[model samples]
Target chain A: TQLLEQSPQFLSIQEGENLTVYCNSSSVFSSLQWYRQEPGEGPVLLVTVVTGGEVKKLKRLTFQFGDARKDSSLHITAAQTGDTGLYLCAGGRGKIIFGKGTRLHILP
Target chain B: GAGVSQSPSNKVTEKGKDVELRCDPISGHTALYWYRQSLGQGLEFLIYFQGNSAPDKSGLPSDRFSAERTGGSVSTLTIQRTQQEDSAVYLCASSPRGGGLTITEAFFGQGTRLTVV
Candidate 1:
């Protein structure tokens, strides 16, 4: 089975702080996706990185795919309370296999 | 684009009762999927539907869980004899295509949170 492991299961940060969450696996993936979900709602897609060593940015959020396609990271700079949510990383076939999410709380 | 949509934002039921969840995918989407998000288990894939055909049912935890898509747009997941362990958010997603079986970015719906007592 392909498994994706996320680190620091939970994180609490104050506004304006910067933080990074990780997703690692022993298996390589063709594509990896990052999602953020608020309480009581489904996850919303953030970005998809297909190639190794690829980097994509959305405003204050930065996503990086590993050189081996076996890991990925999400970095949020100058974080705000609105950034608080459960962050998930899904690997393998870009279809199934979502990692145990990193639950984030940004305090105002 | 209308996005994906699910019905009955929340469901509460007694043990042993059966329940069905619905999903209306985005127009022209050819791929549909079902997933579960429980407290400890995180997100678990349940099934996948391509048009009216299901090529993967590998994720269903038990035979009690079943799903189907008809007319190439709407899908339903039925869970029989509910149990407390089944309480979780049932999520539905759709993608335009997966040309080589590797999916693209999926659009999700507001999941139906099921609470089995």
Candidate 2:
């Protein structure tokens, strides 16, 4: 069984602060994806990183895939109230597995 | 549909009863997935379907939980003898395809919130 472990399960920070969350696993994946989910809605895909050491940026968010494809990180810069939500990292090709997720609360 | 669509945005059921949730994937998408999510938590994968055939059912919590996709377009998840622990937002997603080394984007539905009382 492959499991993705997420660190800092809960994070609360003030506006304009920066934070990084991690997702780690022992199994290698063909691709990794980051998703953001707001209340009452399903997760929305933020980015997909397929290559080892690959990095993708979406506005204030930066996502990195580990060189071994066994880990990933999501860094938020100058996070605002709008950035408050659950961030999840998933890895796989056919049957993607998700991390428990980091619930972020950005204070206004 | 323009995006993945799930029916009965909210469902409240009595314990021991059965319920069925529906999903309509985006046209032409060959891969459909079902997941369950508790409030403020990550997704718990339930099953994966590739063109009307379920290739992975390992995520299904138990025999009480079952799902099927038809015509490679829509899927239905059925839960029998529902329990309180089954209450959660059931989410459905679809990608253009699955497997192989290539990466694909998955589009998700708003999800069906199930409440077992």
Q: Best-fitting candidate, measured by DockQ?
A: 2
lDDT of 2: 0.91
| Residue-by-residue lDDT tens digits, candidate 1, A1-108 | 899999879999999999999999999888899988888777888998999999999999999999998999999999999999899998656356799999999999
Every candidate's CA RMSD: 1.7, 1.1
Please give the DockQ score of every candidate, comma-separated.
Answer: 0.57, 0.76
Question: All candidates' TM-scores?
Answer: 0.94, 0.97
How good is the docking of model 1, by CAPRI class? medium
**Each candidate's interface RMSD:** 2.3, 1.3
Clashes within 3 Å, all models in order: 0, 0
lDDT, candidate 1, B23-61, per-residue tens: 999999988889998864468988888788888889999
C-alpha RMSD over true interface residues, model 2 = 1.3
Clashing pairs in 2: none
